[model samples]
Target: MSSHADHPTVIVGAGPAGLTAALCLARYRHRVIVVDSPGAPRNSASAGVHGHIGMDGVTPAEFRARAWRELSRYTTVERLEDEAEGVSSAPDGGFRVALGSGGTVQAGTVLLATGVVDVHPADVDGFAECWGRSVIHCPFCLGEENAGGSWATVADNAELAGMSAVAFRAWSEDTIAICPETMPGLETARATARSGGGDVVTGTVRRLRHREGALHGIELADGRVLERQTLVWTPRQRQQPVVQRVADELKLTVDEAGFVAVDASQSTGVPGLYAAGDLTSRWKQSVTASTAAGAAAADAIHMAALLAAVHH
Candidate 1:
């Protein structure tokens, strides 16, 4: 086993992205240390992971377990079940990762797979309980199972409301978008929704009604009820607190959309630093996308090493 002084690549966040990267690096006979905080994954509330090709319909826990099992087969990889509390520059030319367990790992390269955190609506009754099950963000992940049922697409803005409503219409024709009356683009939202066989309702969601762990309807503040089986809510999202802290320390470039900016090879414009998964793009935040990003980051690192050796 290589010691910490060897400066193995340190990967933060052990979700699909981090784990897949660790596996790829191990296959290349590169040393890696994966640090994962001890908590439920962001998608733990989800019943199962979808759009992951062969592993579709697997629960988040199951998917993680399978990845762990596969990674254990490699000797060059290490797994740490602790939070990465701080990140800083090492004495040498590498990076230093401080863990919650009062230890630190030295890394020649850093791959940040830390994903974003969804900001749930506050003061909404039953919203927390139904989140990830009945209340979801991604249609590709939860739409198929909830298909053919009434869906209510709730958004703070009319544009998102209309787009979400139209997207949900693919799984169910009984789709309606609910937006605040004061939000802009309501006319466009209404037109778009109508074109997709859906409707736009202007109202404030007072409470969500769920039974047996499933949402049944959405109650408006005006005592009106919109009978719906599922609610597709696109809430605001932010970077994980650790990712933000690291970005601040390293002065990493963050896009206007609040995501870490990375190049085609997942480089964060900083040599020996990379970021992948939802931290880089919000287009398709799925297990498949994450895995692909992880693989790309690993390949980039491997190629960089090869080029350096040839130059020397």
Candidate 2:
């Protein structure tokens, strides 16, 4: 058996949460190894990171590049571009993390920052072509860029349709809520949309109409088309495979949405196992929220280590 390589902490996933935690821990002179895959991040489709203060409008790729460059200043922080295959608790109060690259490491603590994957709207032609540019999920993230433009919100249910219609109105006066006929609470949603100076349509969206990657409209199954310059739709999300594996291995409790359950301090109930970002939160998936959670986890870890050393 290969000997266990050791570190103070091991962070899985290199998105905002993991990177932020790694940076915070490294600043405290803790040894942190960040393991991440080369796959695209959840927000890779976003044109910029919104409501991130200094980083407003920064592209996801550029944000990561800048973070990694900053991390280079801290020698205690190490990064490995490999996927984590498995994780298990060691006998000595550490964690054994197995990598897909056939390597392993033992760490005093583990932070699962593995983010969620979005399930896009199915059977929508041309939607994929303009996903990030003209089609978006969060109005707060991309609303300002397309302000005053014709917008449409496709909801899977009446509640969401109502909520989104009102929210989208903040960005564009010409907003419409589209709901399938089968969805319940159609009247309620329609009422809310009308109250917000928007209109509601009940029909199955057949496809998206786009010209050269720019979204132009949405077509209904009944052959009617609504002219729209932007589309906002929330895709169902699922936790990454690595997160599920870790949860099962450690028997960690997860919320109904499959997000790892953590306390306000970001502790995962299991000793030395923590989680942050989208894997632990759904409603607040912004960059600022993730960064805050990561920093809080680092603080908790630092305090725990201090108490341990003093007792020892």
Candidate 3:
């Protein structure tokens, strides 16, 4: 039987949250192993990290590279460029994390920082090309850069559309909500939009017209074209597979929106299993917020370990 190596903590994702936790734990002289796979970060298409103090406008790739560089200073942190396949309870009152590349690591505590995936509008053509650029989701993340431009929101529901239109007026005066025919409460949404100095157009968006990744406008099924330079839509999001797997394996409580239920300390209520970042939050999905959550989880783990040692 192959023996599994042990660590103080194991982080399942190496995005902002995971990296931050690893850095914090390492700085405190705790041994941690981070398992992550390339091309899995959801923000790869984003041009830069927005609303993050000091690191604002830094590209996602650059931000991760710099974080890894800083983490290299600590010998206690080990980063594996591999996917975390599964997690199981270990005999020693810990957890065993299985890596896709083959091997297992026993961890006294586990921090799942795996983020969520954005589900783009499948019916809208050319959306994939303009995503993270001209077609964005979060207003706070990409609104300032495209301020003053013609903005529109393709919302899934009337309430969301109305709310988005109102919020978008801060960025541009000419804000409109492209309410699809399937959306409910169209009149209410339109009223809300007009109240906020915006308009609501009920139509089926056929496709997005873009040239070389720059959005030109959106074409409607009724052959109407809305000449908008920028489009904002709140895409549906789903948790990553690793997050769901771990949550199920450990029987962690998850909210209706599929976010892991965590306490103020980022604990999942499953003893040493913790979760942070987008996997556990939806309101504030920014680099700064995720990093803060990671740091908080790390501090909690460190304190728990200290108490355990003292009692021992």
Candidate 4:
């Protein structure tokens, strides 16, 4: 059993990043308290986690179950199925994490693995059903599986539509860039799409034709139907409210895209505070990246504790 004062770390997420970090720290014999509520994984809507060696193609639920099972073997780790409502600095240079279930956790260090949230397009029928299956987010993760398949990019902005189309060209030459409104770079994106034997269309997606998450075509508001199979959509994303609240309290810096800014070591620029996973890097948002970040952050925390003990 570990006391609140004795716990070295409190992780505010149970996703890949936080779980991996806790596993590493457990191996190092450091007690860690991980806080996470069920049904909050950013990848819940993703069909399967791809690009992770050995664990590739594993469903998010199974991956999480495996992680929790592994963590259970370590007696030094504590798992709490609760959301961290807020984080504040404590008097002893530690952190005070307020839990949604009416309690406070004191820790010498805090790791913000609370990832971002994707803002899905509203009023789109069948979008929710086909989100993780036919509508994909990461090309590197899910592209190869659907290679040579008819593809479309349903983007709100022209840049995303064009970039997605250009990127999808490697997987499929028959790609279409679809945007709801005309914007700058659309023509360039359209040209790029055409260059790859693809096409571009501007229309609002009314409904997606799919059966049990398998996309068949995209129906437009004007009764136009694009005979496409898979859709590559990169919707707008935002930090979870808890993340923003913590960032505001700590005055943490954020990148231009509004992700929590962290260095190579996953340090939040505030001593003893760290961040990892999708919350820190958008380009490297994957199960592999998150797990690696978690491992690295664990090592850093362990080393920091060693140095502190020597100094004391």
Candidate 2 per-residue lDDT over residues 278-301, each given as its tens digit: 888778888888999999998888
The true-versus-predicted C-alpha distance at residue 34 of model 4, in Å, is: 0.8
Name the runs in model 3 displaced over 4 angstroms.
1-6
Error of 1 at 171 (Å): 0.9
**How many collisions per candidate?**
0, 0, 0, 0
- Better-scoring candidate (TM-score), 2 or 4: 2
Cα error, residue 266 of model 3, in Å, equals 0.5
What would the TM-score be for candidate 1 when compared with the true structure?
0.95
Q: What is the Cα root-mean-square deviation between model 3 and the actual structure?
A: 3.0
Given candidate 1, what's the lDDT at residue 238? 93
Q: For model 1, what is the error of residue 85's alpha carbon versus the real structure, in angstroms, after optimal superposition?
A: 1.0
Residue 54 of model 2, lDDT score: 93
Q: What tens-digit string does per-residue lDDT give for candidate 4 at 114-157?
A: 88888888978988898877888867878877787799887666
Give candidate 2 regions above 4 Å deviation: 1-6
Over 4 Å off, model 1: 1-5, 163-165
lDDT for predicted candidate 3 compared with the true structure: 0.86
C-alpha displacement of 170 in model 4, angstroms?
A: 3.7
**Error in Å for residue 50 of model 2:** 1.9
Score residue 184 of candidate 1 by CA lDDT: 84
How high is each candidate's TM-score?
Answer: 0.95, 0.94, 0.94, 0.93
lDDT score for candidate 4 against the true structure: 0.85
